[model samples]
Target: MKYLVMVQGTQLDYEAMRGKASPHSPAWSEQDVQAMYAHMEAINNDLSETGELVDAQGLAEPAKIRTVTLGDDGKAVITDGPYSETKELMAGYWVLECESLERVTEIADRVTRCPQPEGAPNHPVAIRPIQDGAGDLC
Candidate 1:
């Protein structure tokens, strides 16, 4: 089965990563960022060596987001930037072909353990099964 594992972050988190501290998050040092990158790279490399990785990617800053919504007139309404009300957005994702949900859960657990600055918020890592065909519906 294939599973999608997602990591989330906020605009404030992104700012902190870029060395701008906000009231909500502390600025990340250069070493902090490199540690995180190394951690994620190790995981990806391991998955690739095991032939379990399908795809993986990290997203750009949320400030560059453009949202498209359905208007009352049935037309597309375009909006810029992240949702004003929602702080958390998907920061990255990995698609893994695993033997079972348990295996994917283990991977997600490791993701949650990624290195970060002290006092940094521990965001939840989401895991969902991917449907390959109509038979997978439940």
Candidate 2:
């Protein structure tokens, strides 16, 4: 079966507090983000070689985000990106063809183990089984 794995956004105040001199852990920096990308690329390359990677890509900045939504009036609302009203935003996602949920869980485990910037928050990969034939109607 094919499954989708994506990062879940964290809370806004939790995301906003990170800084260089954070009384605690610092927020993600450009270098931190770059390193994260490198880690993702490495994982993707390995997955591709193992024939586990169905497809995956890094997400763009939230400010450049866009999406379609429905309003109370039932009107189609073409609005800005990401629905998360918090600081933590989806970084990217992956669609993997796996033998079982356990297999995908292992993949998520490895990804969550990735070294992240300080105060990067928890790594929560949401997994969902993709329904087939639904696209046929599309």
Candidate 3:
């Protein structure tokens, strides 16, 4: 089965990673950012070697987001964001083809342990199984 493993962060978190310190998060040093990239690379490499990785990507900053809602006239109403700077938004995700939920859970655990600045928030990692088709009833 395929699973989507996601990690979330606030706008403050993104700023911190870019070395901008705010009351909510500390600035990350160049080394701190490098370490995080290396850790994630290692995990991706391992998954690739094991033939379990489908796709992976990191999202752009929250400031560039566009929210679309249905207007009363049934047209798309667009809103620009840096919406609720403290609200958690998806930071990155990995699509993995794994033998079981336990395997993906183990990978998510490793993601949670990725190195970060000393005062960084411990964000939770989420995993959801992908439904291939209607045959996946349940």
Candidate 4:
């Protein structure tokens, strides 16, 4: 089965990125940020070597995102982000072709273990199966 593993970071998580600092440290440090990326790369590498990874990518900050909806007159309405009501912002995603949900969960668990600022909770990793050929994905 093909699965999508989505990473969601909370508002606090995004705020912590303003300056580099280990969540456990008293001061910001670039090393902490580098370590996080390194950890992510390692996970991606492992998946690639195992031939389970289809695609993976991180998203730009939410401030740069835009939301579109239908207006009262049927015209498109646009809003800029920092969508406050959402508990978490989607940070990144990974697509994988795996044999079972168990395998997908294992991948998600590994993602949750990546390093981040102190007191920042693990970003929720949502794993879902991709439906086969029911309609055009595009």
> Could you tell me the TM-score of candidate 3?
0.94
Q: For this target, which candidate reaches the highest lDDT against the unseen true structure?
A: 1
Candidate 3 CA-lDDT value: 0.93
How do the residues 83-112 of candidate 2 rate in per-residue lDDT, one tens digit apiece?
Answer: 765456666799999899999999888888
At residue 109, candidate 2 shows an lDDT of 86
TM-score of each: 0.96, 0.71, 0.94, 0.85
lDDT of 3 by residue, 5-100 (tens): 999988888899999998888899999999999999999999999999999999998888888989999999888885554488889999999999
In order, candidate lDDTs are 0.93, 0.73, 0.93, 0.81
Q: After superposition, how far is residue 129 of candidate 2 from its true place, in Å?
A: 1.2
Q: Can you give the lDDT of residue 8 in candidate 2?
A: 54
Cα distance off (Å), candidate 2, residue 4? 0.5
Number of clashing pairs per prediction, in order: 0, 2, 0, 3
Rank by TM-score (best first): 1, 3, 4, 2
Candidate 4 residue 69 C-alpha distance from true site, Å: 0.4
The top-ranked prediction according to TM-score is 1
Q: Which ten residues in a row have the lowest lDDT in candidate 3?
A: 77-86
- Candidate 1 lDDT over 49-135, as tens digits, reads 999999999998899899999999999999999889978999999999999999999999999999999888889999999999998
Cα-based lDDT at residue 31, candidate 1: 97
